[model samples]
Target: MHRYANPSRFIRIADTIFPWAGGIMITAFAIGLYLALLKSPADYQQSEMVRIMYIHVPAAWMALFTYAFMALSSAAVLIWKHPIALLSAKAAAPIGASFTVICLATGSLWGKPMWGTWWVWDARLTSVLILLFLYLGYIALINAFDETERGGKAASLLALVGAVNLPIIKYSVDWWNTLHQPASVFRLDGPAIHPDMLWPLIIMAIAFKMFLLTTLVTRIKSELIAARVQNVQRSLHGNLADGRG
Candidate 1:
């Protein structure tokens, strides 16, 4: 793990894996969309409106999963000081933030027809909303300092602190009486969703996961390149100062 922390090594690995991940993401999304939008039957209750689930559910799941990834990476950086872990967390923040916004926006779109409202202050929705703020907050904090290291460390701390919200978002339905639906796929009694709907949802979820991985690698590559450029400039300046001295 530490050996791969070297930027060159990390870039080499990312270069190898990113193309494959991107290809798989594109393929999976194509198949998943076909299964979700074309092949799957409309819900007996919600009809065509349920089609929103294909996009909304996966975005919502990725919202939580991406934060978990960031929090864990932040923890690794704080505890073990792994530069790659920190860079990975930094790379993931914006992507996670975008997904969180999509989840909320799509949820509202789905909700208006079914619930007769565009938004509600339900427990599940509120927790997920807070999750969005957390992402933005992390991003803001990361850019708040003149020293990039200071900003990164401060943002990492915030990410770890905000992680407590993940479980709250997950169990909001169980813990509070809310408009949001309870767990259908992850219940102790087993999944409540039918196979026709379930398979497409699973496929979409996997596609979303791959999509995040694809973007994360790209972002990390950019970060590594930028860092290398900064280091080269700093070294040149230091040598010039020594020569003048």
Candidate 2:
């Protein structure tokens, strides 16, 4: 893991993995969508509206999963000073934020038909909302300083501190009487969901995870290229300065 901290090495590894991840992501999404839309039985209660779960639940999972990854990357950057860790965390923020937004939006769409409201101030909803804010805060902190290193350090610290919310988001449904349902996929004994619905949900979750990996790798590669260009310009400027001096 640390060996790949070097930008050159990281890029080499990412290049190797990117195409495979993209291909798997596309294939998984196609199969998952087919299963979700065509095969899964409609809920007896919510009927066709329950189909939203295929998107909403996965986005919600990714929202929390992305933040957890960011926090871990931030810790790596701060503690080990891994060169690419901060960049990886930075690259993941917008992607996570987008997932959070999708979760919220789709939830609202699902809610309108099921709950008779588009929005609610439930504990689970609020906690996930906070997760979205944390993502935006990280992005802002990372770009706040003129010195890129300073900005990265500050943002990394913020991410580490904000990690407290991840657990809260996870247990919110368990802790309170909320509009959100309890865990159906993961339980102490086994999954509560019927296998027919469960299979599509699992497939969709895999597709979303793969999609995130593909996007994160692309974003990090772009950042690495931009950083390399900046370094080259700085070197040229320094050489010109020394020549004149």
Candidate 3:
């Protein structure tokens, strides 16, 4: 892990993994969509509308998962001051924000038919909203300082602080009387969802994960290139100053 902190090494590693990730991402999405739309039976209660879960539930899962990843990366930044850690946390923000948006939008679409409302202030919903805000806030804070290191430090602290919302989001349905349902896929006993519905959902979740990994690696590579360019400029400037002196 530490060996790949150097941007060049990381880029090579990313290049190696990206092709496989891309192939898997495409395959998963196609198969998952077919299963989700054509093969899976409609919910007895929600009917065809239940198909929204194929998108909504996974988006919600990614929203929480991304935040948790950011928090861990932020911790790595603070403890080890690794450039990859900082870049990874920064790279993950927009992706997480996009997932949060999808979750909220799909949830609203699902809710309208199921709950007779477009939105509600339920515990899970509210906590997930806070997670979205935290992502935006971290992005803003990271870019606020002109000094990159300072900005990273500030954003890292904010990420660590914001991690509290993750658990709240996870257990919101359990802890409160909420519009959201409790866990179905993961539980003490086993999955509540039938294997028929579960397979497509799992496949879609894998697709989402693969997509995120590919995008994050690309973003980190971009950041590394920008940083390299900045360093070259600084070195050139220093050489010119020495020559003049």
TM-scores of the candidates in the order shown? 0.96, 0.97, 0.96
Q: What are the per-residue Cα lDDT tens digits for candidate 3 across 60-138?
A: 8898898899999999999999888998999999999999999999999888888999999999999988999999999
List model 1 lDDT by residue over 129-221, tens digit each: 999999999989987876557788889999999999999999999999999889898889999988989988998998899899889999999
- Provide the clash count, candidate 3: 0
lDDT of 3 at 238: 100
lDDT of 1: 0.91
Q: What is the TM-score (0 to 1) of candidate 1?
A: 0.96
lDDT to native, each model:
0.91, 0.92, 0.92
Cα lDDT tens digits for candidate 2, 1-245? 78787888889888998999999999999999999999999999889987899999999999999999999999999998887888899999999999999999999999888899998999999999999999999999998976557899889998999999998988999999999889888789899888889988998999999999999999999989988999999999999999999
How far residue 76's Cα lies from its native spot in candidate 3, in Å, is 0.9
Predicted structure 3: lDDT: 0.92
Query: What's the CA RMSD of model 2 in angstroms?
Result: 1.2
Stretches of candidate 1 off by over 4 Å are 242-245
